[model samples]
Target: MRYLLPLLFLVALFAMLMLRGYVHNEILADHRIRPDASTDTVPERILDGGPVIDARGTGKPTSLDIPKHKLVLTFDDGPDPTWTPKVLDQLKKYHAHGVFFVTGANAARYPDLIKRMVDEGHEVGLHTFNHPDLSYQSHARIDWELAQNQLALEGAAGIRTSLFRPPYSSFADAIDDKNWPVIKYVGSRGYITALDSTDSEDWQRPGIKTIVKNATPKHGKGAIVLMHDSGGDRSQTVAALDTFLPELQGKGYTFVNLTEALNAPSAHTPVTGMDLWKGKAFVFAVQVSEHTTDVLVGGLAVIGVLVFARFGLMLILSFLHARKVRARGFRWGPEVIEPVSVIVPAYNERECIANTVRSLMASDHPIEVLVVDDGSTDGTADIVEAMWLPNVRVIRQPNGGKPSALNNGIRHARYDIVVMMDGDTVFEPSTVRELVQPFGDPKVGAVAGNAKVGNRDSLIGAWQHIEYVMGFNLDRRMYDVLGCMPTIPGAVGAFRRTALERVGGISEDTLAEDTDVTMAMHRDGWRVVYAENARAWTEAPESVQQLWSQRYRWSYGTMQAIWKHRRAVFERGPSGRFGRVGLPLVSLFMVLAPLLAPLIDVFLLYGLVFGPTQKTVVAWLGVLVIQLVCAAYAFRLDRERLTHLVSLPLQQVLYRQLMYVVLLQSWITALTGGRLRWQKLRRTGAVEAPGGIPTQRGSKENIDRRPVA
Candidate 1:
């Protein structure tokens, strides 16, 4: 059920985006009209017909003309908010009515205009939704356009219009072979095709005098005139109407709508019941989708800024960190060469415990390894006891959680400087030595070590390797510089025993004890720094399910840790610095960023399917390039091979989504007050030891191997 929530949310988001595209005329739109189309199939009678054409009967088609001294005024492409009301006002001033041919797209957006047209005694007609040229549309498309237009009309004004006008239509005499069939089909759909006898050409923004001249009939003849109330810059059309109405009225001509001019029945019929409700539902959906899309676009902009800001900060601060560490004679203060106590918390880690113990036993620094076996039913303690290596001891206890086991080991330790590691991790010989060097600075409390993915032979492992390098390690460097280092990895980290005592031992309040303790140390006025030279190789989860579980706990636990220490934000001195700086960075980069990162992919899909594909692809690839550059820089800093980057793009396509969903599930669990226990991943013991040497099962040959450097 938890997993299904994210999927359902995505489905709903996709649906809203699709609806937004449809209502905005961004999908399946074709607006071109062929001006030089063939006219061989057009009948001679239609070429000489009147403006009102009727082909609904089985016999010959008939056309009707307005009575002498009577003019029918028709406006196309409207119900526009800007100009349609102005045109209607002019008609009302003259106590006249005009027909408004509205496109469904515009009508749905500005339904009040349609209602205003009805309430003010104006006629509304169908101009085909989206304003597509009917001559180029299929029969099904024509039917859909007409039906959708009627639906919009029904929703807006509770009436269906029978008056029809194809987009780009002009004079009745201009009907060609390409358009004759479309006109007949429309007529068969029970609509009277309203073609123009005189065109004002106001759509071209011609001067008012030219428009009035073009729309005037010769010798007091009756005619149907075409002008526009929408489709841009209709000021000339509205001005022409003001003058044309009064001037023509003075010339003994009366203006009326199509029905009045033709002396025929009303072209609009009132609708109600299910049809009315369905229309309303459609309009409602479009409105909601439009508003939702607006909000998503705003979020996308914010995410974009956050992404760029994070990348900029990482690059700048990481360079500063590298320069500071690599500077000659730079050290974390004088090294004291103190012997450290190492703790390995084990629970059903029989497969990797021996290698973990062997690697620690070979550390270049003087160290005593204590394996705290927390009631491992798989005899994880037996594996370490069988090793019988010098300076390594296995302690057995009941199945307390990892925090309890670590606290037990801390109590039994004999060294002031302590190193903590996971049972499945193998550290380099110099890792402990390098990790403990940070403690030479009296103010330093805990040092976070560099953790690497050792099982990188598989695709999933390679992806994790990239993340560890690019996302985790690089972030640690930046955070270290900012004095707000959040987490000391459980795989490899060092702590001052005094600092540990000051913050009380590890708390079981959060699943991420590492992060929880690090924050506590910060609030207790201790410095947490990163040890880049301290590297540990650990097996990364090789399957999607395992990765999801591991990350789910990590993400949720981080949230819990953040919440647990939220009060630090209001504290004074060092605690305040970490709370204000560290907490916001963690919350942005770790939680909120991952949650909103999927918007990039969402818009990419939307653009490809709807339109503007070239721009969309370019934008997406641009983001990918930025990521690639950052990854390359991180790999260089870590001195890792760049070959693993071949899977980076694929990771963005597939693996990023998994991480996003995992983060989302964690958010859901946190918001709902759910509890999560320790989820142990099945380990294969495939991790390589320090110096890239593979660990062998039950092989004592390398137990006494000399420490490297």
Candidate 2:
């Protein structure tokens, strides 16, 4: 049942294609002829014998069987603006009138022609809404087609007709067992099913003489001549009529409308107030559906163009970033051997507190680990104090969120450079040294560390790991080259103490304190650089629900930061560069791209159902190939395993959709001024610090090193 909705959507899209003339059934395809100048065509059959009635006659008369030289002229499949007007003029020239079998689609498009047909004393009848061969359709669909056309006829011409001529019908002889049910249904509805006696075959566009010869009836016999005023070029039919009608009149035959020729009541059917109201409503709905289908197609086209542009731009920028990285050799300026203050913000993170502090203590650079315990009920402070390590301080405070804890920790720091990390993250021994070296340039305000997922054995974790490398790290490289790096991950980032003080320390206005501070630093005229080698491994969510919550906060917080610094776009110098180049790119790839990603699925299904299968598959595979190439490049840059490519397609189908929904909900929450509380994820203790030290309950003996600031 969960799959039913997508199946229904695909079916509806296919029906729309049929309605919009993109897909046609065999009957329609067979009848559809292009109006080309070349006159070569198939010869039409000549009816020299008497008119043939249904093999199993339903007691419906084939013709008037008139004693006088009289005939009924009929046209089908029209109300065409071009050929229809010409046909009507020819009838008017000879003071003649004919019955016109009009399809609802064409009638709705050119109602003025239907009105002219009525005002000029010609007759109107029903052709199915899209000219489908009703023999193959279900009963409900056939009824719907007929009802919709009735409604359209009333709306367009202010009246309903009881005359209906099924498509693909040439004469009475053509109605057989296959079409018997449909004819019976129409008869039950009180409609007169008109059939032709003489086959004009003008639809074939044979020479004018052939059309006239085929349509001319036997001597002393009255007949109904068949022809079309729509579907294709009808000039041959119209020209044939100009010659045939006059010569027939000269031979003492009169052409009259269906009612007069049949000696039957007028084709206009009486209606009730209820029917009239219902008809008007149905007509309005059909119009809206047509317009909406067009809008959907146009929207899909726009989304395709945007997706292509995004892929192209990401490839080009990432390539340039790679070239720049290789040219500079991933080396920072001369190393700054300054003591760094590492602030580990914790809230209910007692499980990983000791491991985080131990990793910091083992850093090659001189550093003090400040584990700010933000009111953890699990004795997180006691666990840090039990370590008995040098230059490690455990500050206990009320639960004030991560930003508040970081601000408190930074205030008591005794170093010029600060490294901020999460309690669940463990850094490499050289992480601090590599992170702080960028400060050797006085203009550099902060350095963003490369974040890796440490618990990537699970499928969900693997997806997040790929995203960190292909999405986050690759984006940072592009951002670094453009000087528009917007985020410094809290997992591992280093900042100059003066730069933090200048930006008023960590901001509590957003959930993403790191991103908020980074944007603030950018606006304050400082360079935020990416330190690719400063790797920190952090535990990622292992379940879909947990991943959703974590990403929701991240997406929501990023939006807040972007909005907060929107004015930077219009500023001068570095701020303006970030606002114009960096901000737009982030917003495009982060927010807008995911928002429009659903179109890929929609178009994929549409193409599969209504378009060529091979082309659709090729196009889809082409997109996936491009993404695979990009992901391969990113993996190589991050020096990670390429086996993660096995999960890329599955990630697109599942993880990518989850991310899009998260971002969409975030947008909705931000737009509605809704407040979201920080959600603490369930810690699995799956990640291990360097030397395989699990921070669960035991593993204290792994922390043997003692270093000082």
Best by TM-score: 1
Model 1 residue 667 CA deviation (Å) reads 2.6
lDDT for 482 in candidate 1 is 94
Each candidate structure's TM-score, on Cα atoms with residue i matched to residue i, is 0.90, 0.78
Among all windows of 10 consecutive residues in model 2, the one with the lowest summed lDDT is 39-48
- Tens-place lDDT digits, model 1, residues 292-379: 8888888788889988999899999999999999999998889859898999999999888877887886789998888898989998
Full-model lDDT for every candidate: 0.88, 0.77
Per-candidate RMSD vs. true structure?
A: 4.3, 7.0
Candidate 1: pairs in clash: none
Residue-level lDDT of model 2, residues 630-682, one tens digit each, is: 88988988889899889998887778777866877787788768888899988
Off by over 4 Å in 1: 35-45, 66-73, 78-97, 207-223, 229-256, 691-709
